[model samples]
Target: MIDDELRARLESLGGLDAGPGSLAGVVVIDVTRVVAGPYCSMILADLGATVIKVEHPDDPDYTRTFPPMLERDGADAFSGFFAQYNRNKLGVTLNLRHPEGKVALERLVAQADVLVENFRPGTMDRLGLGHERLREVNPRLVYAALSGYGQSGPYRGRPAYDNSAQATGGLWSMNGPAGGPPTRVGTIIGDLAASLYGVIGVLAAVRHAERTGEGQLVDVSQQDSVLTLTENAVVSYTTEGIVPEPLGNQHPFVRPYELFACQDGFVFFGGYTDKFWKISCEIFGAPGEFDDNPDLQTMGARFDDAVYAERVKPMVERWFSGRTKAELEALAGDLVPLSGVKDIAEVVADPQIAARDMVVDAEYAGYGSLRTFGSPVKLDRTPPRARGIAPDTGEHTAAIFRDLLGYTPEEIEELRAAGTI
Candidate 1:
């Protein structure tokens, strides 16, 4: 039971007073860990799903140990990394390897709308709680499986991580500067992309189940998701037989549509279109030169490698070298698509981010009010939000077992003693 002070603290969180979210009545059983699966369930939780995140009693989610860790009187209190992706969810502990634990999971599945997991392809089946078995418990359940590779592929059983997915998905080969070594993306795009695809699949499957009363597996693979995100590379190679290489910050088809050095920092400019190019020329005080020089007249003419190297590139470099990012933004940000690159500190302080509700304050257990990213999705009436603080390990175990599973206090004690909770 929550004490009055703790209850009040939770009630004062960012989204608790927002009435109902988009998925108000949905229930999600999250058996995932780390980044990919938890991130997917977190989005569902943000959208008002009652998500119960289950981990083993002895082995909780690994991210719980990740930094930046909070401390209350020098003891480990909370993990900011975990909190970022796991807010707005209930937490429970159950050992699926135990027979009673498996039975408890089946009971939960009987009443759940969706179940998500990110294990090796057949790990759930090995535990005798695979989608096939759970469908017997609830025929309308949407079972989403996120893995390194899809369930049917040859590499499905192989263990993989974000770097592995990037390497295998063809994104690594095309990410770095021209003629440079293959570079992994700065962030975990492979896992993030898979998580989003998993969310999309779950929502669509839930809708199908609601309408047809039949549920199917939603299989999402990190490698496949990352491959799908390799914009134009696959098609360009397939159709034109042109091997794509990293162009650093340049767009392959659009000349001058890349980052340029400013006096202070870098700014990305998209003055590649015909209209924008002319406007850019006017802004650079070279409208007459642009009109008179046939080589820089059309986007096509400027796209030629020799013409760009000889004429257009040096001119843009000279003009941009004289201005700061702020000055360039002030001159051309609204006229053309341009933005001064911002670090995280600057991003959180940006007025547009504040107005759009892209930054929010979340109250952690020991750390009073810390910042976490807000949800990007915005619905007119029922928008998404970081609904609550991340739960401690098995924080709601007793309440969930008593209320949802109809377990007596005596049985709860027995399960706890058996280490099956």
Candidate 2:
């Protein structure tokens, strides 16, 4: 039964609508935090699912206190970064380590359509809340697990972060400059990629359940997910017996496919096809150069010619140096693809981002209004809204217990005293 306190909390967020379903009836139990799992669940919530995020009462998500903490309107200021990833979901605190907490969780699972957890391999089983256990209670529950390594590998129990996954998954080796040490990507690429894959798996499972009334387990590994993004690098090494290293910003087998300096900053230029290369030469008034040397005449030949790179570098630099990034972009137009490398600030303030409503206003009761990234996906009939500020630890304890879980005032106090809610 839904507790009155929980119901009150939901009411504060505009009570859950129970009408004809359109993802509106789906309930997502979010037992994961940090980047990947939270990101995946947020996508589900954006699509109109009711997501209840369960965090530990005492050791609430560490992200809540991440840098740039603000003190606002009587409540502790939440980290902006934390708020960004956690929007569009309801927050509740539960000490899953306790028996009472476990019982409460079972209650939640009974009504949930999907449950996402990112605990290490075997952790859920240890808690008796693994996929098999949950399926026993709710046969139609889609239990999705996200981990660093897979559930049954030799490395299954090993802990991993984004950098570790990048290293182990072969992404770092092919990322940086040719002579530089293997470098992890600037962002949590592995985590984000894994989250996306998890979402795909969950959605697929959800559809299958809707059709056949059968739910299944979704096991996603960050290592495995990131390997997919490595593309041909893995295959090249396996098929050709060549261990690939970083090629800097250049494509391993493509000539003129790298970033070049202009008079101002930098511009990435790639003319992959022979026809495009011919056009590039013509644009730079170097058509004769494309025709003269047999090695420079074809794509494959140009790719293998180290000396040819030196010969062409100066010309490429000179042509780019004469124009501003905007001018160069205009000159290339649809004929050639060119982009000005932008930093985060520039990306945030970009006209395209603004026009697409990629940044939105989120109202925190204490903070007034805060800006965060809007949903990246668009739905014709169900657009997502930034619902509310991330809840303070245990802020909704009384509300969730009294409203949604149907607990009485006495029971709430008893649980609080017992340190179980």
Best by TM-score: 1
Model 1 quality (TM-score): 0.95
lDDT of 1: 0.86
Give the per-residue lDDT digits (tens) of candidate 2, residues 85-171: 776677778888899988888988987889999989899899888999999988989999999997878999998888778888899
- What range of 10 consecutive residues in model 2 has the weakest lDDT sum? 13-22
Model 1 clash pairs? none
lDDT of 2: 0.78
Off by over 4 Å in 1: 1-18
